[model samples]
Target: MSSHAPRSPFRAGAGAALGAPALAMGVSFLAFGAAVAAAGLGTGWALGASLGVYGMAGQLVLLQAAGTGDPTGATLGATAANARFLPMAMALAPWLGAGPRRRWLALPFIAITPWAAAMRVLPGLPEAARLRWFLGFALVSWLVAGLATWLGLLAAPWLRPPLLAALLFANPLYFALLLAAEGRLPASRLPILAGIAAAPLAVLLPAAWGLLAAGLLGGTLAFLARRPWRRGGG
Candidate 1:
């Protein structure tokens, strides 16, 4: 009788696959923590937000609202900022492909970076290993983000505005580069172009509204542009 190697739930490549995105998220969260500290929210609250909310945009919204001393507005703002996750969940549903309980449990780990990384990596992974890899990747990413938040909060006292601005800029730059890496696809071009064209106009709108508008317009244009190609199988 021949024996086969036992199946491993974890992939050797899983940890390394998300290293760059995890580092980028850590830096972004470091900036976020500094911003929160500068706002006088303290490290505990910042770390708590990292663990509980795990969303940079929503945390920023909460901080902004707290500054205004408006609890209701803060709640609404955070909700609106996090509204993007709903569509994100829908988009990821097919990729996750598991029992409801498992997918539901993993929902908290969903974020822009993880979603993008998973989209790029999961297709190549066996179905059984995908969830495990995602969970492991997300855990490491979350820990890095949380630790960076703590360090940033501690270092906030010494950081200057320009330095903090540069730190904050890293996240967007990383995301832009990620998108550019994927821009070889015809479907991506129209949306990227639309977003660029819409940026100035978006800036004139309220912050949340502006993001929503740009995404909707850009995504709509991309969808329309892709229809013909998709139908033609080209």
Candidate 2:
């Protein structure tokens, strides 16, 4: 580890959290808990989704699919929903340094919130401190999610249709805001803007395919726009 590394990067990471993204994730987990209860699954199932699946979109899909008595399909759907993380993890790979830091223990915690935070700040940090910082941020996020799930399940009986639906919608909406903010980076901005523009078109496609289509189309356009010949034009 470099001497420049903060002795308490993990603590610093912990302190960096409990913020807006955490709040958003909390709200989403609340929705997940409510969904769990509504799906006729119990408290353990809700907590399992939070601690295990960890991804909100995947958690919701897991709940729905699990209810259908098709475990294999449920697993596949949930796995597919969280496939976005593969790229995110890959992007963070270089910052994690070598050996264990590049492996399972730290990588499991790379959720959207912490990943975005890492992109904003990790480049400025000591390489030795980066994983600790991410671990700290991610642990706080994980706890917030778990607590929120408990509360939401407790409140499930009272939350109604429109409200529940609205809560369910909140996570993805906030994720867009995260992406828009990430767009401040010159490399990420064009694709993010393009994705935002293509979002409306996503509605015209099948629910599952829409977002995927929007992302691929948007990212492709952004990549083209940034080509050497089209540099200033982008």
Candidate 3:
């Protein structure tokens, strides 16, 4: 008889990310890889941005600004596009730990996909398991994004024009799918509903500010809707 080691929670979490969501993420980054190749930024830059930026929209923003030959504007644009991460990190903090040290370690990984999945999945997990699970999932997702970016760049030049257009929609479509999948959970749906409903009103602002407003507003509404003050002794 052969024996296999029992998987840790971290490995289990990573396995979860290997499914449909990760596939969509990889498909979506194909466009980004193409864009990076088109931009002449090289594979190193594409992979670095995929890891360091983490957000698809932010990577696009950085790519666009890079063309202007102004590193400052590129940096600012990417930062602005990813401003939604501020509220996300805040919302995820209590789940990671009460200590700033733990929070800081995990906060950097709070991109849309992992954060959304975490919000939907973490409450049911043991407190000790949540952080490890989250890290495992997010790290795998990040690696997949980086790998897809390189592959996309290599394949982009050979891909048909129409196929490239289709790839661009994959990420947003995955987000929509995730929202629908999590809709069964009432608590989890609150912020998603709020963000979608409020995003239109935010259109008056710049893209980054609009993103920030939607995330902040949605997170605040969800937090308050839960009425933590009554529940909190912390």
- Candidate achieving the largest TM-score: 1
Off by over 4 Å in 3: 1-6, 97-104, 218-234
Clashes of 3: 0
Model 3 Cα lDDT, one tens digit per residue, 22-69:
898898887789888887789889988888888988888888888898
Candidate 2: C-alpha RMSD to true structure equals 4.1
**Which of 1 and 3 is the better model by lDDT?**
3
TM-score quality measure for candidate 1: 0.86
TM-score of each: 0.86, 0.84, 0.85
Give a tens-digit lDDT track for model 2, residues 56-105. 76777778788788999888778767776787788887776536635466
The segments of candidate 1 whose C-alpha lies over 4 angstroms from its true place after superposition are: 1-14, 228-234
Least accurate 10 contiguous residues by lDDT in model 1 = 5-14
The C-alpha lDDT values of all candidates are 0.77, 0.81, 0.82
Cα-lDDT of candidate 2: 0.81
| Candidate 2 residue pairs in clash (backbone atoms < 3 Å) | none
